[model samples]
Target: MLTPLVDPDGAPFWEYAAQGELRVQACAGPDCGELRFPPRPCCPHCRSFDSEWRRMSGRGRIWSYVVPHPPLLPAYAAQAPYNAVVVELLDAPRIRLVGNVVAAPDAPLNSVDPARLRIGAGVKVAFTLLDDITVPRWLLERT
Candidate 1:
């Protein structure tokens, strides 16, 4: 299984996730208020060092996805057909996150059917505690 390596810039992300909250790093520049993922120390838009963690609505759409045939990671061999999805946040379409879609907040990677996923399908964020780190996952929204 994969694990997240928390760094100074990304520590807040994990802290929020542990509390079951979804947040994104946003540039605090007055003229360049932009939201970014994979939290960074400097704003890519304005080169500003000031930033803040903003809570997200946890709503987004599937921008892309894939089901690895030959599991690349040996730990994932047992979950061969699991999916890795790219989701674009509803409020920030330019910001996308990669994760798996499960039936519930804490379900397994393969809990959701691969065939059921579709581009533009609505999804909501969910947190799962893995190895003491709470990671964000996705769940398909019921139409």
Candidate 2:
């Protein structure tokens, strides 16, 4: 599996995942609490430099997905035919995260059958440690 480069702005997200918590960065401005992803130093909503990590429910629905074809990079070729999904968070509808829908937290990317995936299907967050970082994956709500 490929590891994500941890930048200062997104360090907190990885830290929370390591503790089994899914959180999103939000503006800490007194009157503005807009959430933002790709954690940045400033808020696009209120132009605030202050920010905080807000705990999320980790529930979402598949908003979109695509099953990749062959000719993938070596690092991902082994996981070919797997689906990459865009999940829309339940609590924060506007916030969508990109990941794979797997059968288990540590399961391989192709663990879930491609035929089983569908847009609008409910999913819950599952975490798996990749190297020193714990990353979040999604599992079907029913199975």
Candidate 3:
């Protein structure tokens, strides 16, 4: 199974997801409160080391998506046709996250049909335990 590489800077993200909460790291600098995904050790905006993990509303839209054909990593080949999505948070549109869109929180990566995905489609955060890490997945929001 392909797993995420949890580094010290990004550990908190996985920790929050494991607890069923979606959180993003934000710079705590006085003049720069930039929200960043794929957490980093220092703030890119103000180059500040100070930061905080802020809970998200779990609302977002599909900014982009892809269904890999063949030539995928060996571990992911079995889950071919899975939709990988880039979701732009409603509150922080600048911060986008990469994840798979599933039918339910615990569903497999192929649960959602690839043809059903669309850019600009609304989605919400969902967490699932994959291997030893809890990762965030996306679910299409119903009208």
Every candidate's CA RMSD: 1.1, 1.0, 1.3
Worst-scoring 10-residue span by lDDT in model 1: 71-80
Instruction: Tell me the spans in candidate 1 whose CA falls farther than 4 Å from its real position.
Output: none
Q: What is the TM-score of each candidate against the true structure?
A: 0.96, 0.96, 0.94
**Of the pair 2 and 3, which is ahead by lDDT?**
2
For each candidate, the alpha-carbon lDDT, in order, equals 0.92, 0.93, 0.90
Q: Write the per-residue lDDT of candidate 1 for residues 2-31, one digit (tens) a residue.
A: 899999999999999999998999999888
Per-residue alpha-carbon lDDT of model 3 for 1-143, expressed as tens digits? 57899999999998999999999999999989899877998998899999999999999999999898872777777777788889999989998999989999888788888888999999999898888899899999973
Model 3: lDDT to the true structure = 0.90
| Worst window of 10 by summed lDDT in candidate 2 | 71-80
lDDT of 2: 0.93
lDDT of 1: 0.92
Q: CA shift at 46, candidate 2, in angstroms?
A: 1.1
Candidate 2: where is the Cα deviation over 4 Å? none
Residue 46's lDDT within candidate 2 is: 84
Give the Cα-based TM-score of candidate 2 against the true structure. Answer: 0.96
Q: Which candidate comes out best when scored by lDDT?
A: 2
What candidate 3 gets wrong by more than 4 Å, as runs, is none
Residue 10 C-alpha lDDT in model 3:
92
Q: Mind sharing the TM-score for model 1?
A: 0.96
Q: Write the per-residue lDDT of candidate 2 for residues 1-143, one digit (tens) a residue.
A: 77889999999999999999999999999899999998999999889999999999999999999998872667888787798899999999989999999999999998999999999999999999988889999999976
